[model samples]
Target: MNSGILPAAVAGFSTGLSLIVAIGAQNAFVLRQGARRHAVLAVVGICAASDAVLIALGVAGLGAVVTAWPAALTVVGLAGGAFLTCYGVLAARRALRPAAAAGLTTQGTSAGSVRTAVLTCLALTWLNPHVYLDTVLLLGSVAADRGSLRWAFGLGAMLASLTWFTGLGYGARLLGGVLARPAAWRVLDSLVAATMLAMGIMLLARTF
Candidate 1:
Protein backbone atom coordinates (compact mmCIF):
# COMPACT_ATOMS: atom_id res chain seq x y z
CA MET A 1 0.00 0.00 0.00
CA ASN A 2 1.55 3.27 -1.04
CA SER A 3 1.58 5.67 1.94
CA GLY A 4 0.06 8.35 -0.26
CA ILE A 5 -3.05 6.26 -0.77
CA LEU A 6 -3.94 6.53 2.90
CA PRO A 7 -3.82 10.32 2.91
CA ALA A 8 -5.78 10.49 -0.34
CA ALA A 9 -8.47 8.22 1.08
CA VAL A 10 -8.68 10.25 4.24
CA ALA A 11 -8.95 13.44 2.25
CA GLY A 12 -11.63 11.90 0.09
CA PHE A 13 -13.61 10.87 3.15
CA SER A 14 -13.42 14.33 4.65
CA THR A 15 -14.45 16.00 1.43
CA GLY A 16 -17.34 13.62 0.77
CA LEU A 17 -18.62 13.85 4.31
CA SER A 18 -18.51 17.63 4.24
CA LEU A 19 -20.49 17.76 1.01
CA ILE A 20 -23.37 15.65 2.34
CA VAL A 21 -23.77 16.47 6.02
CA ALA A 22 -25.86 19.52 5.23
CA ILE A 23 -29.61 19.70 5.95
CA GLY A 24 -30.70 19.34 2.37
CA ALA A 25 -33.88 17.73 1.08
CA GLN A 26 -32.31 14.27 1.03
CA ASN A 27 -30.94 14.47 4.56
CA ALA A 28 -34.24 15.85 5.84
CA PHE A 29 -36.14 12.93 4.36
CA VAL A 30 -33.66 10.50 5.82
CA LEU A 31 -33.95 12.15 9.24
CA ARG A 32 -37.72 12.11 9.17
CA GLN A 33 -37.79 8.47 8.14
CA GLY A 34 -35.24 7.44 10.71
CA ALA A 35 -36.87 9.32 13.57
CA ARG A 36 -40.11 7.58 12.77
CA ARG A 37 -38.39 4.18 12.29
CA HIS A 38 -40.03 3.86 8.92
CA ALA A 39 -38.21 1.88 6.25
CA VAL A 40 -34.98 3.40 7.45
CA LEU A 41 -32.66 0.71 6.15
CA ALA A 42 -34.09 0.96 2.67
CA VAL A 43 -33.85 4.71 2.60
CA VAL A 44 -30.27 4.73 3.81
CA GLY A 45 -29.31 1.97 1.42
CA ILE A 46 -30.74 3.86 -1.53
CA CYS A 47 -28.97 7.06 -0.59
CA ALA A 48 -25.64 5.37 -0.11
CA ALA A 49 -25.99 3.35 -3.29
CA SER A 50 -26.97 6.37 -5.33
CA ASP A 51 -24.00 8.32 -4.09
CA ALA A 52 -21.63 5.46 -4.75
CA VAL A 53 -22.76 5.24 -8.34
CA LEU A 54 -22.41 8.98 -8.86
CA ILE A 55 -19.00 9.16 -7.26
CA ALA A 56 -17.82 6.13 -9.22
CA LEU A 57 -19.10 7.64 -12.42
CA GLY A 58 -17.33 10.85 -11.62
CA VAL A 59 -14.05 9.08 -11.06
CA ALA A 60 -14.56 7.01 -14.21
CA GLY A 61 -14.60 10.17 -16.28
CA LEU A 62 -18.35 10.53 -16.80
CA GLY A 63 -17.77 14.07 -15.71
CA ALA A 64 -16.42 14.88 -19.15
CA VAL A 65 -19.56 13.58 -20.80
CA VAL A 66 -21.79 15.52 -18.40
CA THR A 67 -19.82 18.67 -19.05
CA ALA A 68 -20.28 18.18 -22.74
CA TRP A 69 -24.04 17.93 -22.31
CA PRO A 70 -24.92 20.63 -19.82
CA ALA A 71 -28.51 20.51 -20.98
CA ALA A 72 -28.87 17.17 -19.28
CA LEU A 73 -28.59 18.80 -15.91
CA THR A 74 -31.10 21.42 -16.90
CA VAL A 75 -33.63 18.70 -17.61
CA VAL A 76 -32.90 17.09 -14.30
CA GLY A 77 -33.10 20.40 -12.47
CA LEU A 78 -36.58 21.14 -13.72
CA ALA A 79 -37.90 17.74 -12.71
CA GLY A 80 -36.21 17.80 -9.34
CA GLY A 81 -37.39 21.32 -8.58
CA ALA A 82 -41.01 20.50 -9.32
CA PHE A 83 -40.88 17.34 -7.26
CA LEU A 84 -39.27 19.10 -4.29
CA THR A 85 -41.76 21.93 -4.43
CA CYS A 86 -44.70 19.55 -4.50
CA TYR A 87 -43.35 17.48 -1.64
CA GLY A 88 -42.71 20.66 0.32
CA VAL A 89 -46.27 21.76 -0.23
CA LEU A 90 -47.46 18.45 1.14
CA ALA A 91 -45.25 18.83 4.18
CA ALA A 92 -46.61 22.29 4.79
CA ARG A 93 -50.13 20.95 4.56
CA ARG A 94 -49.33 18.31 7.14
CA ALA A 95 -47.85 20.96 9.41
CA LEU A 96 -50.87 23.20 9.01
CA ARG A 97 -53.37 20.41 9.50
CA PRO A 98 -52.27 19.02 12.83
CA ALA A 99 -55.43 16.99 13.11
CA ALA A 100 -54.61 15.25 9.89
CA ALA A 101 -51.01 14.90 10.96
CA ALA A 102 -52.12 13.38 14.24
CA GLY A 103 -53.84 10.55 12.47
CA LEU A 104 -50.75 10.04 10.34
CA THR A 105 -48.32 10.41 13.23
CA THR A 106 -50.38 8.60 15.85
CA GLN A 107 -49.42 5.34 14.28
CA GLY A 108 -45.78 6.27 14.69
CA THR A 109 -45.38 6.14 10.89
CA SER A 110 -45.95 8.41 7.98
CA ALA A 111 -48.48 7.63 5.26
CA GLY A 112 -45.65 6.93 2.83
CA SER A 113 -45.00 3.36 1.83
CA VAL A 114 -41.59 1.88 1.14
CA ARG A 115 -42.19 2.31 -2.58
CA THR A 116 -43.11 5.94 -2.11
CA ALA A 117 -40.08 6.58 0.05
CA VAL A 118 -37.87 4.83 -2.47
CA LEU A 119 -39.25 6.83 -5.35
CA THR A 120 -38.94 10.10 -3.49
CA CYS A 121 -35.40 9.26 -2.48
CA LEU A 122 -34.51 8.47 -6.07
CA ALA A 123 -36.08 11.68 -7.29
CA LEU A 124 -34.37 13.73 -4.62
CA THR A 125 -31.02 12.21 -5.52
CA TRP A 126 -31.08 11.71 -9.28
CA LEU A 127 -33.11 14.67 -10.38
CA ASN A 128 -31.15 17.27 -8.46
CA PRO A 129 -28.51 18.89 -10.67
CA HIS A 130 -26.44 19.76 -7.62
CA VAL A 131 -25.68 16.09 -7.09
CA TYR A 132 -24.04 15.95 -10.52
CA LEU A 133 -22.43 19.36 -10.20
CA ASP A 134 -20.91 18.57 -6.85
CA THR A 135 -20.30 14.86 -6.98
CA VAL A 136 -19.65 14.28 -10.66
CA LEU A 137 -18.10 17.54 -11.79
CA LEU A 138 -16.45 18.94 -8.71
CA LEU A 139 -15.49 15.73 -6.93
CA GLY A 140 -14.60 13.99 -10.17
CA SER A 141 -12.42 16.86 -11.25
CA VAL A 142 -10.73 16.87 -7.88
CA ALA A 143 -10.17 13.14 -7.94
CA ALA A 144 -8.72 13.38 -11.43
CA ASP A 145 -6.12 15.73 -10.08
CA ARG A 146 -4.85 12.81 -8.00
CA GLY A 147 -3.62 11.07 -11.17
CA SER A 148 -3.02 7.43 -10.27
CA LEU A 149 -4.85 7.72 -6.93
CA ARG A 150 -8.17 8.94 -8.34
CA TRP A 151 -9.82 5.59 -7.75
CA ALA A 152 -8.46 5.51 -4.23
CA PHE A 153 -10.00 8.89 -3.59
CA GLY A 154 -13.25 7.75 -5.14
CA LEU A 155 -13.30 4.69 -2.88
CA GLY A 156 -12.70 6.87 0.14
CA ALA A 157 -15.46 9.24 -0.90
CA MET A 158 -17.83 6.32 -1.42
CA LEU A 159 -17.02 4.95 2.00
CA ALA A 160 -17.57 8.31 3.55
CA SER A 161 -20.99 8.55 1.93
CA LEU A 162 -21.99 5.09 3.12
CA THR A 163 -20.81 5.74 6.67
CA TRP A 164 -22.45 9.12 6.88
CA PHE A 165 -25.86 8.07 5.55
CA THR A 166 -25.89 4.99 7.73
CA GLY A 167 -24.96 7.00 10.76
CA LEU A 168 -27.42 9.77 9.99
CA GLY A 169 -30.29 7.40 9.34
CA TYR A 170 -29.67 5.35 12.45
CA GLY A 171 -28.44 8.16 14.68
CA ALA A 172 -31.55 10.25 14.23
CA ARG A 173 -33.46 7.65 16.19
CA LEU A 174 -31.84 9.15 19.26
CA LEU A 175 -34.26 12.02 18.79
CA GLY A 176 -37.24 9.79 18.22
CA GLY A 177 -38.69 10.67 21.57
CA VAL A 178 -38.66 14.39 20.93
CA LEU A 179 -39.85 13.93 17.35
CA ALA A 180 -42.65 11.64 18.46
CA ARG A 181 -44.47 14.52 20.05
CA PRO A 182 -47.06 16.29 17.95
CA ALA A 183 -45.43 19.65 18.55
CA ALA A 184 -42.08 18.27 17.54
CA TRP A 185 -43.52 16.59 14.51
CA ARG A 186 -45.04 19.86 13.45
CA VAL A 187 -41.74 21.62 13.84
CA LEU A 188 -39.83 18.96 11.95
CA ASP A 189 -42.27 18.92 9.11
CA SER A 190 -42.25 22.68 9.00
CA LEU A 191 -38.50 22.68 8.60
CA VAL A 192 -38.68 19.97 6.00
CA ALA A 193 -41.23 21.99 4.11
CA ALA A 194 -39.13 25.09 4.23
CA THR A 195 -35.93 23.36 3.22
CA MET A 196 -37.53 21.47 0.36
CA LEU A 197 -39.38 24.48 -0.99
CA ALA A 198 -36.37 26.72 -0.80
CA MET A 199 -34.05 24.23 -2.50
CA GLY A 200 -36.65 23.46 -5.12
CA ILE A 201 -37.11 27.13 -5.88
CA MET A 202 -33.38 27.67 -6.08
CA LEU A 203 -32.95 24.79 -8.51
CA LEU A 204 -35.77 26.02 -10.68
CA ALA A 205 -34.61 29.60 -10.53
CA ARG A 206 -31.09 28.64 -11.46
CA THR A 207 -32.20 26.47 -14.34
CA PHE A 208 -33.87 29.45 -15.88
Candidate 2:
Protein backbone atom coordinates (compact mmCIF):
# COMPACT_ATOMS: atom_id res chain seq x y z
CA MET A 1 0.00 0.00 0.00
CA ASN A 2 2.96 2.32 0.54
CA SER A 3 3.65 4.53 -2.46
CA GLY A 4 7.38 3.79 -2.27
CA ILE A 5 6.92 0.05 -2.68
CA LEU A 6 4.06 0.08 -5.19
CA PRO A 7 6.16 0.21 -8.35
CA ALA A 8 8.46 -2.58 -7.19
CA ALA A 9 5.52 -4.79 -6.32
CA VAL A 10 3.89 -4.19 -9.67
CA ALA A 11 7.13 -4.96 -11.45
CA GLY A 12 7.52 -8.11 -9.42
CA PHE A 13 3.98 -9.22 -10.17
CA SER A 14 4.41 -8.73 -13.88
CA THR A 15 7.74 -10.53 -13.95
CA GLY A 16 6.51 -13.39 -11.83
CA LEU A 17 3.44 -13.96 -13.98
CA SER A 18 5.51 -13.84 -17.15
CA LEU A 19 7.82 -16.55 -15.90
CA ILE A 20 5.16 -18.74 -14.32
CA VAL A 21 2.82 -18.66 -17.32
CA ALA A 22 5.15 -20.76 -19.44
CA ILE A 23 4.24 -24.29 -20.38
CA GLY A 24 6.30 -26.70 -18.30
CA ALA A 25 6.16 -29.99 -16.43
CA GLN A 26 4.67 -28.41 -13.34
CA ASN A 27 1.99 -26.55 -15.25
CA ALA A 28 1.02 -29.61 -17.22
CA PHE A 29 0.68 -31.69 -14.08
CA VAL A 30 -1.34 -29.00 -12.37
CA LEU A 31 -3.69 -28.74 -15.32
CA ARG A 32 -4.30 -32.47 -15.35
CA GLN A 33 -4.84 -32.68 -11.62
CA GLY A 34 -7.16 -29.72 -11.76
CA ALA A 35 -9.19 -31.16 -14.61
CA ARG A 36 -9.49 -34.42 -12.75
CA ARG A 37 -10.62 -32.62 -9.59
CA HIS A 38 -8.17 -34.70 -7.63
CA ALA A 39 -6.87 -33.18 -4.44
CA VAL A 40 -7.08 -29.82 -6.14
CA LEU A 41 -6.68 -27.78 -2.97
CA ALA A 42 -3.66 -29.70 -1.75
CA VAL A 43 -2.03 -29.56 -5.15
CA VAL A 44 -2.59 -25.84 -5.45
CA GLY A 45 -1.42 -25.21 -1.89
CA ILE A 46 1.82 -27.13 -2.38
CA CYS A 47 2.60 -25.29 -5.59
CA ALA A 48 1.93 -21.81 -4.21
CA ALA A 49 3.66 -22.53 -0.91
CA SER A 50 6.69 -23.96 -2.65
CA ASP A 51 6.93 -20.91 -4.84
CA ALA A 52 6.66 -18.64 -1.79
CA VAL A 53 9.44 -20.49 0.01
CA LEU A 54 11.73 -20.44 -3.00
CA ILE A 55 11.02 -16.76 -3.66
CA ALA A 56 11.71 -15.97 0.00
CA LEU A 57 15.01 -17.82 -0.22
CA GLY A 58 15.86 -15.88 -3.33
CA VAL A 59 15.02 -12.58 -1.64
CA ALA A 60 17.22 -13.72 1.25
CA GLY A 61 20.19 -14.20 -1.11
CA LEU A 62 20.28 -17.97 -1.17
CA GLY A 63 20.75 -17.86 -4.90
CA ALA A 64 24.46 -17.56 -4.22
CA VAL A 65 24.43 -20.94 -2.55
CA VAL A 66 22.62 -22.45 -5.55
CA THR A 67 25.07 -20.90 -7.96
CA ALA A 68 27.96 -22.36 -6.00
CA TRP A 69 26.47 -25.86 -6.11
CA PRO A 70 25.21 -26.56 -9.59
CA ALA A 71 25.50 -30.30 -9.07
CA ALA A 72 22.44 -30.27 -6.85
CA LEU A 73 20.31 -29.11 -9.76
CA THR A 74 21.78 -31.80 -11.97
CA VAL A 75 20.73 -34.46 -9.50
CA VAL A 76 17.24 -33.01 -9.38
CA GLY A 77 17.07 -32.90 -13.16
CA LEU A 78 17.86 -36.59 -13.44
CA ALA A 79 15.20 -37.55 -10.93
CA GLY A 80 12.62 -35.21 -12.43
CA GLY A 81 13.29 -36.47 -15.92
CA ALA A 82 12.76 -40.05 -14.81
CA PHE A 83 9.53 -39.22 -13.06
CA LEU A 84 8.23 -37.29 -16.04
CA THR A 85 9.02 -40.08 -18.42
CA CYS A 86 7.13 -42.52 -16.25
CA TYR A 87 4.14 -40.18 -15.99
CA GLY A 88 4.14 -39.70 -19.74
CA VAL A 89 4.05 -43.41 -20.33
CA LEU A 90 1.08 -43.75 -18.04
CA ALA A 91 -0.71 -40.91 -19.79
CA ALA A 92 -0.01 -42.45 -23.15
CA ARG A 93 -1.38 -45.76 -21.98
CA ARG A 94 -4.50 -44.10 -20.63
CA ALA A 95 -5.04 -42.36 -23.93
CA LEU A 96 -4.92 -45.68 -25.71
CA ARG A 97 -7.67 -47.09 -23.49
CA PRO A 98 -11.01 -45.45 -24.02
CA ALA A 99 -12.69 -46.99 -21.00
CA ALA A 100 -10.01 -46.00 -18.53
CA ALA A 101 -9.82 -42.50 -19.89
CA ALA A 102 -13.58 -42.02 -19.83
CA GLY A 103 -13.89 -42.82 -16.15
CA LEU A 104 -10.97 -40.74 -15.02
CA THR A 105 -12.46 -37.28 -15.25
CA THR A 106 -15.88 -37.94 -13.77
CA GLN A 107 -14.96 -39.87 -10.67
CA GLY A 108 -13.64 -37.87 -7.74
CA THR A 109 -11.48 -40.79 -6.63
CA SER A 110 -10.18 -41.73 -10.03
CA ALA A 111 -6.90 -39.96 -9.53
CA GLY A 112 -4.23 -41.08 -7.09
CA SER A 113 -4.65 -40.72 -3.32
CA VAL A 114 -4.24 -37.29 -1.74
CA ARG A 115 -0.85 -38.12 -0.28
CA THR A 116 0.37 -39.45 -3.59
CA ALA A 117 -0.92 -36.38 -5.38
CA VAL A 118 0.79 -34.10 -2.86
CA LEU A 119 4.06 -35.98 -3.21
CA THR A 120 3.87 -35.78 -6.98
CA CYS A 121 3.16 -32.06 -6.81
CA LEU A 122 6.11 -31.55 -4.50
CA ALA A 123 8.41 -33.52 -6.76
CA LEU A 124 7.28 -31.55 -9.78
CA THR A 125 7.88 -28.29 -7.92
CA TRP A 126 11.26 -29.10 -6.36
CA LEU A 127 12.85 -31.38 -8.91
CA ASN A 128 12.64 -29.04 -11.89
CA PRO A 129 15.89 -27.09 -12.35
CA HIS A 130 14.14 -24.29 -14.18
CA VAL A 131 12.23 -23.42 -11.01
CA TYR A 132 15.48 -22.65 -9.26
CA LEU A 133 16.81 -20.70 -12.21
CA ASP A 134 13.66 -18.65 -12.58
CA THR A 135 12.67 -18.13 -8.96
CA VAL A 136 16.09 -17.99 -7.31
CA LEU A 137 18.49 -16.51 -9.82
CA LEU A 138 16.32 -14.40 -12.09
CA LEU A 139 13.62 -13.29 -9.70
CA GLY A 140 16.11 -12.95 -6.86
CA SER A 141 18.27 -10.64 -8.90
CA VAL A 142 15.27 -8.56 -9.85
CA ALA A 143 14.13 -8.30 -6.26
CA ALA A 144 17.63 -7.30 -5.12
CA ASP A 145 17.45 -4.27 -7.35
CA ARG A 146 14.43 -3.18 -5.33
CA GLY A 147 16.68 -2.55 -2.29
CA SER A 148 14.40 -1.39 0.54
CA LEU A 149 11.39 -2.82 -1.30
CA ARG A 150 12.81 -6.31 -1.87
CA TRP A 151 10.36 -7.92 0.49
CA ALA A 152 7.53 -6.05 -1.16
CA PHE A 153 8.62 -7.36 -4.51
CA GLY A 154 8.88 -10.86 -3.16
CA LEU A 155 5.41 -10.59 -1.63
CA GLY A 156 3.98 -9.42 -4.94
CA ALA A 157 5.61 -12.32 -6.72
CA MET A 158 4.28 -14.70 -4.10
CA LEU A 159 0.83 -13.23 -4.56
CA ALA A 160 1.05 -13.89 -8.27
CA SER A 161 1.85 -17.53 -7.61
CA LEU A 162 -1.13 -17.90 -5.31
CA THR A 163 -3.51 -16.15 -7.67
CA TRP A 164 -2.40 -18.12 -10.71
CA PHE A 165 -2.55 -21.51 -9.03
CA THR A 166 -5.91 -20.87 -7.40
CA GLY A 167 -7.38 -19.81 -10.72
CA LEU A 168 -5.85 -22.72 -12.61
CA GLY A 169 -6.81 -25.35 -10.05
CA TYR A 170 -10.33 -24.09 -9.58
CA GLY A 171 -10.99 -22.90 -13.09
CA ALA A 172 -10.31 -26.36 -14.45
CA ARG A 173 -13.54 -27.63 -12.98
CA LEU A 174 -15.40 -25.81 -15.71
CA LEU A 175 -14.20 -28.52 -18.08
CA GLY A 176 -15.37 -31.39 -15.92
CA GLY A 177 -18.41 -32.21 -17.98
CA VAL A 178 -16.59 -31.91 -21.25
CA LEU A 179 -13.66 -33.99 -20.05
CA ALA A 180 -16.07 -36.70 -18.94
CA ARG A 181 -16.35 -37.91 -22.49
CA PRO A 182 -13.92 -40.55 -23.70
CA ALA A 183 -12.85 -38.55 -26.73
CA ALA A 184 -12.06 -35.55 -24.60
CA TRP A 185 -10.05 -37.64 -22.18
CA ARG A 186 -8.16 -39.20 -25.04
CA VAL A 187 -7.25 -35.81 -26.40
CA LEU A 188 -6.25 -34.48 -23.02
CA ASP A 189 -4.18 -37.52 -22.15
CA SER A 190 -2.44 -37.49 -25.51
CA LEU A 191 -1.50 -33.87 -25.01
CA VAL A 192 -0.30 -34.62 -21.52
CA ALA A 193 1.78 -37.51 -22.82
CA ALA A 194 3.43 -35.37 -25.45
CA THR A 195 4.07 -32.48 -23.07
CA MET A 196 5.54 -34.72 -20.40
CA LEU A 197 7.73 -36.62 -22.85
CA ALA A 198 9.14 -33.48 -24.39
CA MET A 199 9.86 -31.89 -21.02
CA GLY A 200 11.41 -35.10 -19.70
CA ILE A 201 13.68 -35.45 -22.68
CA MET A 202 14.79 -31.85 -22.37
CA LEU A 203 15.59 -32.26 -18.68
CA LEU A 204 17.52 -35.46 -19.31
CA ALA A 205 19.48 -33.81 -22.08
CA ARG A 206 20.48 -31.03 -19.74
CA THR A 207 21.72 -33.57 -17.22
CA PHE A 208 24.04 -35.29 -19.67
Candidate 3:
Protein backbone atom coordinates (compact mmCIF):
# COMPACT_ATOMS: atom_id res chain seq x y z
CA MET A 1 0.00 0.00 0.00
CA ASN A 2 1.13 3.51 -0.75
CA SER A 3 1.91 5.81 2.17
CA GLY A 4 -1.10 7.96 1.34
CA ILE A 5 -3.29 4.92 0.82
CA LEU A 6 -2.74 3.75 4.40
CA PRO A 7 -4.33 6.81 5.90
CA ALA A 8 -7.23 6.78 3.44
CA ALA A 9 -7.87 3.09 4.06
CA VAL A 10 -7.82 3.60 7.80
CA ALA A 11 -10.33 6.40 7.46
CA GLY A 12 -12.57 4.20 5.33
CA PHE A 13 -12.35 1.29 7.77
CA SER A 14 -13.19 3.52 10.73
CA THR A 15 -16.07 5.18 8.95
CA GLY A 16 -17.50 1.85 7.81
CA LEU A 17 -17.37 0.41 11.32
CA SER A 18 -19.04 3.47 12.77
CA LEU A 19 -21.91 3.16 10.31
CA ILE A 20 -22.39 -0.61 10.54
CA VAL A 21 -21.74 -1.29 14.22
CA ALA A 22 -25.09 0.03 15.25
CA ILE A 23 -27.81 -2.61 15.50
CA GLY A 24 -30.46 -2.33 12.81
CA ALA A 25 -32.77 -4.60 10.86
CA GLN A 26 -29.83 -6.09 8.98
CA ASN A 27 -27.71 -6.67 12.05
CA ALA A 28 -30.60 -8.18 13.97
CA PHE A 29 -31.24 -10.66 11.19
CA VAL A 30 -27.59 -11.60 11.01
CA LEU A 31 -27.40 -12.02 14.78
CA ARG A 32 -30.43 -14.29 14.86
CA GLN A 33 -29.09 -16.49 12.08
CA GLY A 34 -25.75 -16.64 13.83
CA ALA A 35 -27.34 -17.71 17.09
CA ARG A 36 -29.19 -20.46 15.28
CA ARG A 37 -25.86 -21.61 13.84
CA HIS A 38 -27.39 -22.47 10.49
CA ALA A 39 -26.66 -20.94 7.14
CA VAL A 40 -24.24 -18.64 8.88
CA LEU A 41 -21.70 -18.67 6.09
CA ALA A 42 -24.26 -17.98 3.41
CA VAL A 43 -25.84 -15.12 5.29
CA VAL A 44 -22.54 -13.47 6.09
CA GLY A 45 -21.31 -13.89 2.54
CA ILE A 46 -24.42 -12.26 1.12
CA CYS A 47 -24.18 -9.29 3.42
CA ALA A 48 -20.47 -8.73 2.89
CA ALA A 49 -20.73 -9.25 -0.84
CA SER A 50 -23.69 -6.92 -1.07
CA ASP A 51 -21.80 -4.24 0.79
CA ALA A 52 -18.82 -4.68 -1.50
CA VAL A 53 -21.01 -4.31 -4.55
CA LEU A 54 -22.68 -1.21 -3.13
CA ILE A 55 -19.30 0.25 -2.24
CA ALA A 56 -18.04 -0.46 -5.74
CA LEU A 57 -21.10 1.17 -7.21
CA GLY A 58 -20.64 4.13 -4.96
CA VAL A 59 -17.04 4.38 -6.08
CA ALA A 60 -18.32 4.24 -9.66
CA GLY A 61 -20.61 7.18 -8.91
CA LEU A 62 -23.98 5.42 -8.70
CA GLY A 63 -24.70 7.14 -5.42
CA ALA A 64 -25.09 10.39 -7.33
CA VAL A 65 -27.64 8.74 -9.59
CA VAL A 66 -29.59 7.20 -6.67
CA THR A 67 -29.87 10.62 -5.15
CA ALA A 68 -31.47 11.93 -8.28
CA TRP A 69 -34.21 9.28 -8.07
CA PRO A 70 -35.75 9.18 -4.61
CA ALA A 71 -38.65 7.29 -6.11
CA ALA A 72 -36.49 4.21 -6.43
CA LEU A 73 -36.09 4.13 -2.68
CA THR A 74 -39.77 4.71 -2.20
CA VAL A 75 -40.59 1.60 -4.16
CA VAL A 76 -38.11 -0.53 -2.29
CA GLY A 77 -39.18 0.92 1.03
CA LEU A 78 -42.79 -0.15 0.51
CA ALA A 79 -41.88 -3.72 -0.33
CA GLY A 80 -39.26 -4.03 2.39
CA GLY A 81 -41.50 -2.61 5.07
CA ALA A 82 -44.28 -5.01 4.22
CA PHE A 83 -41.97 -7.97 4.16
CA LEU A 84 -40.37 -7.02 7.46
CA THR A 85 -43.73 -6.54 9.04
CA CYS A 86 -44.74 -10.08 8.12
CA TYR A 87 -41.46 -11.58 9.25
CA GLY A 88 -41.73 -9.75 12.53
CA VAL A 89 -45.19 -11.12 13.09
CA LEU A 90 -43.89 -14.62 12.57
CA ALA A 91 -41.11 -13.99 15.04
CA ALA A 92 -43.57 -12.60 17.52
CA ARG A 93 -45.60 -15.76 17.18
CA ARG A 94 -42.53 -17.87 17.85
CA ALA A 95 -41.68 -15.81 20.88
CA LEU A 96 -45.14 -16.41 22.24
CA ARG A 97 -44.67 -20.18 21.87
CA PRO A 98 -41.74 -21.49 23.83
CA ALA A 99 -41.83 -24.85 22.08
CA ALA A 100 -41.43 -23.39 18.60
CA ALA A 101 -38.59 -21.11 19.63
CA ALA A 102 -36.83 -23.96 21.42
CA GLY A 103 -37.27 -26.27 18.49
CA LEU A 104 -35.59 -23.63 16.32
CA THR A 105 -32.31 -23.96 18.20
CA THR A 106 -32.30 -27.78 18.38
CA GLN A 107 -32.92 -28.50 14.73
CA GLY A 108 -30.65 -27.13 12.05
CA THR A 109 -32.39 -24.97 9.50
CA SER A 110 -33.60 -27.19 6.63
CA ALA A 111 -32.78 -26.66 2.99
CA GLY A 112 -36.08 -24.89 2.49
CA SER A 113 -35.43 -22.80 5.54
CA VAL A 114 -31.96 -22.00 4.26
CA ARG A 115 -33.46 -20.79 1.03
CA THR A 116 -35.89 -18.68 2.98
CA ALA A 117 -33.07 -17.33 5.12
CA VAL A 118 -30.98 -16.44 2.07
CA LEU A 119 -33.88 -14.62 0.45
CA THR A 120 -34.61 -12.73 3.65
CA CYS A 121 -30.96 -11.85 4.04
CA LEU A 122 -30.87 -10.47 0.52
CA ALA A 123 -34.00 -8.42 1.09
CA LEU A 124 -32.67 -7.06 4.36
CA THR A 125 -29.46 -6.05 2.63
CA TRP A 126 -30.72 -4.62 -0.66
CA LEU A 127 -34.15 -3.32 0.25
CA ASN A 128 -33.22 -1.37 3.34
CA PRO A 129 -32.76 2.25 2.23
CA HIS A 130 -30.28 2.97 5.00
CA VAL A 131 -27.77 0.64 3.31
CA TYR A 132 -27.56 2.92 0.31
CA LEU A 133 -27.31 5.97 2.54
CA ASP A 134 -24.50 4.51 4.61
CA THR A 135 -22.60 2.32 2.14
CA VAL A 136 -23.16 4.18 -1.10
CA LEU A 137 -23.70 7.88 -0.54
CA LEU A 138 -21.84 8.39 2.72
CA LEU A 139 -18.95 6.04 2.05
CA GLY A 140 -18.77 7.12 -1.54
CA SER A 141 -18.62 10.80 -0.63
CA VAL A 142 -15.86 10.13 1.88
CA ALA A 143 -13.95 8.01 -0.62
CA ALA A 144 -14.36 10.67 -3.27
CA ASP A 145 -12.66 13.07 -0.93
CA ARG A 146 -9.60 10.82 -1.02
CA GLY A 147 -9.06 11.61 -4.73
CA SER A 148 -6.47 9.16 -6.07
CA LEU A 149 -6.77 6.86 -3.02
CA ARG A 150 -10.53 6.55 -3.25
CA TRP A 151 -10.36 2.99 -4.52
CA ALA A 152 -8.12 2.05 -1.63
CA PHE A 153 -10.60 3.62 0.74
CA GLY A 154 -13.40 1.64 -0.85
CA LEU A 155 -11.44 -1.59 -0.44
CA GLY A 156 -10.96 -0.81 3.21
CA ALA A 157 -14.67 -0.25 3.61
CA MET A 158 -15.36 -3.58 1.93
CA LEU A 159 -12.97 -5.26 4.34
CA ALA A 160 -14.76 -3.66 7.23
CA SER A 161 -18.03 -5.19 6.09
CA LEU A 162 -16.48 -8.62 5.71
CA THR A 163 -14.69 -8.46 9.04
CA TRP A 164 -17.69 -7.26 11.00
CA PHE A 165 -20.15 -9.71 9.49
CA THR A 166 -17.77 -12.63 9.79
CA GLY A 167 -17.11 -11.87 13.43
CA LEU A 168 -20.75 -11.24 14.21
CA GLY A 169 -22.01 -14.33 12.41
CA TYR A 170 -19.45 -16.79 13.65
CA GLY A 171 -18.76 -15.23 17.02
CA ALA A 172 -22.41 -15.54 17.95
CA ARG A 173 -21.96 -19.30 18.11
CA LEU A 174 -20.12 -18.87 21.38
CA LEU A 175 -23.50 -18.05 22.90
CA GLY A 176 -25.11 -21.28 21.76
CA GLY A 177 -25.24 -22.69 25.28
CA VAL A 178 -27.35 -19.80 26.49
CA LEU A 179 -29.43 -19.62 23.33
CA ALA A 180 -30.09 -23.33 23.69
CA ARG A 181 -32.40 -22.56 26.56
CA PRO A 182 -36.06 -21.96 25.84
CA ALA A 183 -36.40 -18.81 27.89
CA ALA A 184 -33.34 -17.33 26.30
CA TRP A 185 -34.71 -18.12 22.88
CA ARG A 186 -38.02 -16.53 23.77
CA VAL A 187 -36.27 -13.38 24.84
CA LEU A 188 -34.13 -13.37 21.74
CA ASP A 189 -37.10 -13.88 19.47
CA SER A 190 -38.99 -11.17 21.27
CA LEU A 191 -36.16 -8.75 20.74
CA VAL A 192 -35.86 -9.77 17.15
CA ALA A 193 -39.58 -9.25 16.64
CA ALA A 194 -39.48 -5.81 18.22
CA THR A 195 -36.43 -4.78 16.20
CA MET A 196 -37.94 -5.97 12.96
CA LEU A 197 -41.31 -4.36 13.57
CA ALA A 198 -39.75 -1.07 14.62
CA MET A 199 -37.52 -1.00 11.58
CA GLY A 200 -40.39 -1.91 9.29
CA ILE A 201 -42.51 0.87 10.69
CA MET A 202 -39.62 3.29 10.43
CA LEU A 203 -39.01 2.37 6.82
CA LEU A 204 -42.69 2.73 5.96
CA ALA A 205 -42.90 6.05 7.77
CA ARG A 206 -39.88 7.41 5.93
CA THR A 207 -41.43 6.51 2.62
CA PHE A 208 -44.59 8.35 3.52
Q: Output the number of the TM-score-best candidate.
A: 3
Please give the distance, in angstroms, between residue 164's alpha carbon in candidate 1 and its true position after superposition.
1.1
Per-residue lDDT tens digits for candidate 3, residues 1-208, read 5799888888888888888999888898899899999899999999999999999998877788789989998998998898888889988999999988878877767899999899999998888888887789988998998999999899888999999999999998998999879999899889989989999998899888
lDDT of 1 by residue, 36-140 (tens): 777889999999999999999999989888889888889998999999999999999989987766554445444567778888888888988989989998999
Total clashing pairs for each candidate? 0, 0, 0
Report lDDT (Cα) of residue 94, candidate 3: 91
**Candidates in descending TM-score order:** 3, 2, 1
| C-alpha root-mean-square deviation, each candidate | 1.8, 1.6, 1.0
Q: Which candidate would rank higher by TM-score, 1 or 3? A: 3
TM-score for all predictions? 0.95, 0.95, 0.97
In model 2, which runs have C-alpha deviations exceeding 4 angstroms?
108-112
Candidate 1, superposed: residue stretches over 4 Å from native: 104-112
Inter-residue clash pairs, candidate 2: none
Scored against the true structure, residue 56 in model 3 reaches a CA lDDT of 94
Off by over 4 Å in 3: none
Residues 1-208, candidate 2, lDDT per residue (tens digit)?
6797888888888888898987777887888899998899999999999999999999998889888988998999999999888988998999999999877755655345777889989988998888999999889999999998999999999999999989888898899888868999899889889988898888999899
TM-score of 3: 0.97
